[model samples]
Target: MFVSLGNLQTLYLHNNDISSIETGTFSHTPRLQRLELYGNNLTSIPQGVFDGLNQLQYLSLYSNHMKTIPPNTFINLQQLLYLYLHDNEISSIPTAAFANLPRLQQLCLSSNQITHIQSGEFSNLPQLRELQLQSNQLTSIPTVQYQFPELIHLNLHNNNITDIPANAFSNQPKLSTLHLYSNRISTVSLTAFTGLANLNTLYLYNNQLTDLPDYLFFGLSSLSNLRLQDNDILQIFPNTFTGISSLTYLLLNGNSLKTFPSEELSKISSIAVLYLQNNQMATLSFTAYDMMLSDVSTVDISNNPWQCDCQMVSFRLKMTGSNSFENQITCTDPRHNRRLLKNINPEDLTCEEPMIVRFEKGDDNSVEEGETLHMVCEASGIPTPDITVILPSGLHETVESGGRVIVEVNGTVTITDVTAADAGLYICIAASPVGSAFKTLSVDVQSKEPATVTSAVINITGKPESTLGSAPIFSLPVLLGSVIGAVAGTVLIGCLILMIWCKRKAKNPPPVPDTSVVFNNTNTTATVTTSGHDQTGQGWSHNVTNPGYAQRPAAPQPTLDLYEDVEPPPNRPTSKGAGPKQPAKKKALKPPKRNKAPHDERPSPPPPRTGAAAGAAAVYANEPAAALDNLPYYQPLTKN
Candidate 1:
């Protein structure tokens, strides 16, 4: 075992047949700083083999058969900075194994059999700047609350890590590059990267992420490139990319995304390249196209299941105008299926004899004033026609099947919770690539009436032939029951609507009138309490405490006066319920009573209290929108 090399500062014995290092073999090399024993047949390193190498800073033992690292094997190597133990059979890093190595900045334990690393294993390496634990059997990163302030790069790719907890990268502000791709990560907390303020490159591709959490990238404000391709993400929340405002390249290819992340992408103006290939999206929504960025130099929208139909007519025009990705996009549906979108003509995109298909309910197309109308226009075409409905009120609603009204990709129109406001002629424009068909459906919303006139007064505008046809015979008792049910449903629905309206009004109360305050004395400043919590220390009361005002003589002093107590408006309940009606609390400090002598008076009311005016706006803290945000995140209203 050659233990006589005492003054060795560097030793290169790599690619050797050494199967084992004897105890005390390195006892003589007290000043060893660089030790290269890589590509060796060493199965085990003795406990005290490196006990005397206190100056060891570089140790390369990678590509070896070493099954385990003995406790304190490198105990005295306080100067060790670079430890390369990758491509080895080492399974786990023992607690305090690399203890006391203050200068150890780079640790490469990649390509090992390590399944778990005890918490305190890297705690002693305070100066660790780069850590590589990739290509291992680790199912998760060790739970550690340590702040790695100096760490810059961390590679945990090709592992089995399933989840990242909140503040997973805590306090590593200098960390700029993180590679966690090719892992099995499915869930990440909102604060997973809480302290990664300087992170610039993040690779989470080839994982199992189904949906991105809200504000997922909130801390990486310095991030420039983000790779999240090859995941199962179906939709992105509006502010998922809250951070990374300066991102230039975002890769989202090879996912299940059906809707484009227009809102999130629009926040980042520096985005130069955008990848959205291989998704379930047929076409971009109107909002997405409206916010299309100009700085995007390259866009990859190819490989998606694009439906080239009438709804796409407008989008096709935009797609054609977008010469950058025009040739890349293609249709995945009938007729034009597999055809390049750029090659399709605008005249070729129209509907084929599109006409209304009267269904069971609303068969005659005439619906009750309160009942919903669900209708579909059947059109014979290769690619199904897209339906766009225009209401009588000049409101052009592009139907994509949602909301109080929904337009499905299959030319179905649904008007949920309809009312008299919806009674009018609705023009349904069914369009495909071949041609378009316009059909006018008149909706005569009938009003509620007595049992005797229910059949006679009910207007029917769907078909003249159907209305002229024989009316269905009904018994007197059936007619009575129908009328009773109609009245009951109307009353019940009206009550529910009223209750909902009252609840909303109570949750977000309107602002009260301005409470003006005039400070006649310049010797003191008043700290106005804007929060209306109570009467004394809190409330709508303007507290004017003038310690100097009390010094004035009592006679002819004009005390600061307040108006009458604010009463709750009609049918409005106060926040704390009605309190005992008493004199409204006003500031005790008062201005000198008109200075009795006219010569001493300024002859005008003081300027309006600017402070009171500004503070009034934020007095109500429990606004409905703020209260609702704590309840649940908003889901997609509707998508094409």
Candidate 2:
């Protein structure tokens, strides 16, 4: 096949039907500097096929049927500078397939079925400057990790990549151009291109991007072109273009943007070309119109559903004399359908007066103190009107007043922690350029009642008890103990009173009986000793004339002392004279038989005789029994 062509410097075997080759096909071409085997039907590459081609600097096996790359296929091609294996059926690259190619500068593996690439597959090629991997089946970009520090170009467009992760291209600091368009990229990390400081052109168009985050290009100072068109981007943040100061072209066409990035684009004074066509925008703001006329040179904002209402009058007036928007801007409103914005008369863009539809005049409302009050003041008009709520303090506030009252953009007022000072007439004014309307709400903030002091005073022991704000409650155990204590104190007071009354009755003694008795001196008036007389002083008498009385012996009487001054009886015989009157003999007194007394008819005790009458009765009771016996047989007279 090339057995003797050792000085071959360039060989073109492309566009042929060469499918099979021997292992030593390139062994004889040791000085070959270029080889092209593209547009062939080669299905496989044998190991060590280019073993002796040490000076091979260029190789092309593109548009072939090779499905895999052998690890040692290009082992001896150390001087390879260009490799093109695109438009093939190759699905993967071996780890060491291109390991020895130190001088490889450009590699084109685009338009292949390669779903992934092994890490460090192209690490040994320090001089690699361009890598084309577009129109492949790769789902995501590989993490190069500075493997190709000297590389300057990377093309990965039209792949199945779903998302661009953070620092996806950080290793490629010198990369000036990145082609990531026409992929399935729905989300891109905020720092996806953080280290691509020198990036000049970025193509992110024709993807599923919904929105661009703030500071997404914070460090891309050198970026000139940013193609974000043909995506589902809804809005571009205000700071999305903060660091791309040199950005000159911005393509945001064919997206779902209802509003333009006027604030973001106007800040970048270097933007030259602006594409906002085929979007859902109804009208552009004044800032966007001004930016288009002064800062941007080329502006294409056609094919949008423009609403030519009162709000679009300013934009239409600004576009009156400009021919750049001759047919690009048309109205979709029924009043001016398909009419060019520059052709419409400014006077026709009139609006109705703003009318407060939600709140009525003199709407009475009340709120308790320390409560929240929400009042809705909705209005309707051609253009949205600003709301202002005049507070009771005569202060006019639009959004918020101090910290207690807040007004939302949708015309709702929130008064939190309302106090008595917040009560009064609140006038809500909805004003716009066309006309103004208002609604009044009389708010009555009921003040809270003052705290009261309640007290309970109990005088249990004739002393003041406890005072409290409210009646105190006692537990069952405490209440039982208090009741028991009260009962014990009452019982102690009764017992002390009884003991004092009993001690006052023991101060008097009983009277003593008389110690002496007397008798009569005459025999006719003989006295009997009767110390046993009844309480009435009646003496007992025995009649000896009766037969029954003579049979019984007479009872002896108790002796009593006779008075020495009395004379003796004349009938008595004179006996030996007693030296002194002998004391009368005593006898034992018998206990008196008392008649049985009724239970309730006890006889009253006789009052003790304490005067001289008691002494006379005692004097007649000591007479001897012989003298009293003769007198009693003869009936003696009773004493009065």
Candidate 3:
């Protein structure tokens, strides 16, 4: 079908509509070194079609309608170094279809419909360096089990690979660049790139990665450029880039990072260009800005929800003096939406509103009267807010160092010797140019109970200088002791008075009983007589003073008439001098006095009527010394 052309080194047949090629048509070109058959309508290659082209070094069958390749199709083309079969309808390749091509260096099967490749199909290609299988229906990485020692580049992007298993590229030690972007890759094993010591560039963007595993790039020390943008990456592991020290370019934009990746970037200090735009970051800290701007030469952090508050003061200051940023770092806040970040002044970077951090004590507090009270109000704002404390007495204190109520500069309020008047709501106002924040505290001051003798002593003796304008504090025990002592003393005095009265009454006995006379007959007359101070016919007499010396008035001598059951003559009256003479009275006998019992043997006086009085008596009796000790000694006040 063709004449012999042994010296032809190249042939151009691309961009033609050739649908079929006759058998033995390329048999005449024995020494052909290059053949361009791309942009053709070829469907299937016949068996042993290239058996005569042993000297062919380059072949182009790309952009064709080829579906499958015959067995040993390029077996005779042992010297072939470049084979372009990409952009074809090839679904599957037969076993050993490309096995004998020992000198092949570049193989392109990209944009094909190949699903899976059988093992050992391309194992014999010892000189192969680059393989392109992108835009295929491949579910997993091919040629992973086989070693491509000399292969330098591999493109598996835009595939159906959901996960990169451990050591997926371990066989490709000499690989410098890998293309795994635009895949369904959600997770990459930590050791996936273990043997990729020579890897320089990696593209894994536009994937479903949520996070990068720690130490995932441990052995990739030579990696310089890593693109992981346009991913669902929420966070980067702390040690994910541990050994990637040579990294210079990093693209982490278009992610779900809520915070700046400072720790991860700290590991890659050599980064020169960084892209962190289109993230979920609301505000950046000063530390984050310093870390980002210190070493990176070019950084793109735009399109983030930047909060232009006090937190962005440092960032604004740094941007104000620099001219390196070209893109507009727009703010998303309502106050400065769509405004460039560099245009905002540092002094104008006030917070949306003043924030009250907290109160040292709770909002509702309690304190005892005459006690020191302290409360702290912590607040934060952009313009260094001025703190003022409003007292319950409607007094406003901005800065106080020494007084009954003091509000310190650090938002601390101290009130010495708190009284009932100090109990109420205290308001802490933190005002700034932007806004103000208020914190209210309610304090209940419990009034002290009435004091006793001991309480008075303690109050007089307590430190007076510390609580100058406030009430003096009293102790509970002192108050209680004073009350008890006063009660006991009253009861003791009453008992003593009663005892003295009783003793005086017992010492003097009533005058001797009065003598009475009775007459049974009408003719008899009788006169009464008594001893001791004029008893007057009465039985009992009380001479509280000197009863023994007093004598009763001598009554007339008693006369007795003994008339039994007989009426005497009515007119028979005895004359005053002629009356019957009274018999001489017998001498009165004096009673002997009984000796008093010893004090120890005497019974205790009936325990002073039981109850509060009895208890007080018992206490005073049992602990007389203690009661005496607690008694207050009065001293006359001097005009000192």
Winning model by lDDT: 2
On a 0 to 1 TM-score scale, where does candidate 1 land against the true structure?
A: 0.55
For this target, which candidate reaches the highest TM-score against the unseen true structure? 2
Candidate 3 segments whose C-alpha is farther than 4 A from its true place: 317-319, 345-348, 352-640
Tell me the tens digit of each residue's lDDT in model 2 across 1-640.
7877879899999999998787888778889998999999999998878888888888999999999888867877888889999898988887888777878899999988988887767767788889999999989878763467877888999999999888898877799988999999998898888888899999999999998889999999999999999999988898988988999999999998887778878669899888999998877667777878888889898999886778887777767564585468788866788888777888987677889988632344888899888888898765566789898988787863457778886888887888888889989899976789998878888876544433565555654563334566666566677899889988888777776665543443231232222322322333233333333334343222223211232433464232211233335332322223323333333323345355566445322222222212222233453543333111133233
Root-mean-square deviation of candidate 3: 26.6
Model 1 Cα lDDT, one tens digit per residue, 1-640: 5467677799999998888777777777788789999998988887767777778889999999988876667777888889999999999777767777889899899999998877667776679999999999989866473457798999999999999888788767789899999999999988888878788899999999999877888868899999999999987988887767889889999998876787767778788888998887776655555555355777888888887766667767765354566776688777787898668996776545444453223457577766778776555554555667887776766653356777666666777777788888878776655667777777777764434433453337776555543467676678789999999999999999999999988987763323333343464354433222221222223344445432211221234223222322333222324324333333332222223335444445333232322211212223443442232111111222
Query: Listing every candidate in turn, what is its Cα RMSD in Å to the true structure after a full C-alpha superposition?
Result: 36.6, 21.9, 26.6
lDDT of 3 at 404: 84
Q: After superposition, how far is residue 208 of candidate 2 from its true place, in Å?
A: 0.8
Q: Which residue pairs of candidate 2 clash?
A: 517-618, 518-619, 518-620, 529-621
Following a full C-alpha superposition, what root-mean-square deviation does model 2 have from the true structure?
Answer: 21.9
The per-residue C-alpha lDDT of model 3 at residue 618 equals 16
- Candidate 3: tens digits of C-alpha lDDT, residues 498-557: 999899778865644322212122332212221122323212212122123323333433
Sort order, lDDT high to low: 2, 3, 1
Candidate 2 similarity to native, TM-score: 0.56
Model 1 Cα displacement at 430 (Å)? Answer: 15
**Better-scoring candidate (lDDT), 1 or 3:** 3
